[model samples]
Target: MSRWIVVLAALLTFSSAGAQTLKVRHDHDPWGKCVGELSFSENGIVFSSEKEEHNWSWGWTDIQTVDRRSESEFSILSYADQKFLLGRDRPFDFTVLEGRGMDDTILGLIQSHLPRPVVDRLPEEVERVDYEVNVKHLHTFGGCEGVLRFGPDVVVYDTSHAKDARTWRMGSAIVGVWSVGKFDLELEVYEREGGDLLRTRRFRFQLKEPLDPDFYYHLRRKLVPVR
Candidate 1:
């Protein structure tokens, strides 16, 4: 009947496929923090804590989305509301304390399980791209520099601004894509912004090289098919 008992019971069901585990620091507030192990498995994600009250388990269906704000930091947003936070959904923010932060392999695994868009800022160490071009990602004021790499089923924007960089799976994260001039393009993705679910975010890019018709047409056809 205890809360931790339920959490442990759920954890036991996981047939951990080596159960990718990460050492994480979950800071509850300025003065309080819980150091724990976050394990991603076939069942769901579970946080094991020494402080029993802080322990929790979430199934894939209960997750709203996952945000990889940066390589070392990420948050798992869930549908459950926190009574203390004025009924807003509480996000489990974690900072990786060990190993190579999050890589594409981990993100790929997580995205495959949850039918939700994930924000990935880390770039792959090695990738074979169908097309790649130097581009400037436009912001409200100035912008950041990055390379826009398009693969068969992926679109990656890797930038010097690590926080600005993003890797989006074409079919899952991307909603649509468009281009205006031969040098400007935009990509739309599903995101929860300002507490809005599935609210789309557009990233506009100014291509350093002319947007080749071959690449643009292929990407556009994939984003928006002919009726």
Candidate 2:
């Protein structure tokens, strides 16, 4: 009987160990009036948001946290990037919409609006990069678009209204290697007639670590200024 009891105890201990759970975290945007959260586990990664008077949710599967250090320090590798670093404790420009939760929505909307072939030709890693859209007429749905490159090839274009223009305006072609963090992107807004260059504006921001559940609960209660 003593021998049987010992074997059963060992099995129970092993089963409990396999049931452990993982946590995730994220940064809050005060200016934008939104909250972004990230969670992770042995299963996969999930992203959620409660802001702008509406709740939005999205996620990515087949995600594994190959490396973990502390609450604010870790690295993740996914299907796209072989290596990605996460700094949860460290705070960056959390207010910037480019790196916020709406990224997926904007990408989806733009892809839906533009030609499918153009989006298909884009590099697979393009989705991993950060971007910003400056809207002039929100109702009209027109503004400037810019993409920041982590490897190479940065592109910026404009979708502005024109008096006699048949098509949308193509902003000045700014081509250069952009750093990983946030940057001031200068794109020229042009008119349809003679392709007249209108003006250039600099958009500023910084790139922080990716969102995770462990970090989200940590900062969700705290308040950070948007601007």
Candidate 3:
């Protein structure tokens, strides 16, 4: 059979086996705490999140990893075109560009781009974590409910602990990438407070593949939505 045909068959088989779910850790913002989980099967991919401080939870499923290129570039077909690029040697340059669709369409796009080897070499396990922090002005009232007005605003240190701060702060996304086999990865940190972003960081690690699919899934899903 041709390589493409074999890949398609493998994807079909994997999808039918059942969905595989992975956990993502987020520790970027001080005020916003987020943990994202994703599942993939023959049908496609699904993403769910457990976030504190938000009024409602969010989730999406039936995403396919249609195309895969090297460890850096791939494409998925969902709404417009979901593209994944790992840059020359800088995998931290990892980007998930959205096409035309609801905010949920990116998941489907990612599903359509997964490479055959990456899918075929599925690891038995995977793991990941993200951390963030935010400092915001706290509001307080003086007396009666009707007389409630802004009190002394203080900088409140918030992390994943707060159950009411789900909307991520601006410029507050930090990411870490891990490749299980050779252990190749990268870390990117962004500043989310103040009118101007004042800080940023990046790091790299060497890892191998047939790495952990679960690990990659966790990392990808944990990514803060860029508005």
Best by lDDT: 1
Clashes of 1: 0
The candidate maximizing TM-score is 1
**Model 1: per-residue lDDT, tens digit, 1-227?**
99999888777765436578888888773357888888887778889987899898989898989888876898888888877768878677889988867666677678889878887766754366888999999989999998988888778888889877877888888988888899999999887776545468999999999999988898888878778
List residue ranges in candidate 3 displaced over 4 A.
1-16, 26-33, 52-227
Please provide the root mean square deviation of candidate 3 (C-alpha atoms, Å). 20.4
Looking at model 3, residue 215 earns an lDDT score of: 41
The candidates, ranked best first by TM-score, are 1, 3, 2
User: Lowest summed-lDDT stretch of 10 residues in model 1?
Assistant: 9-18
Question: What's the CA RMSD for each of the models?
Answer: 7.5, 21.3, 20.4
**lDDT of each model, Cα atoms only?**
0.82, 0.28, 0.31
Provide backbone clash counts, one per model. Answer: 0, 18, 46
Runs of candidate 2 with Cα error greater than 4 angstroms are 1-25, 28-38, 51-70, 73-227
Give candidate 3's error at residue 90 in angstroms: 19
On the 0 to 100 scale, the lDDT of residue 69 in model 1 is 80
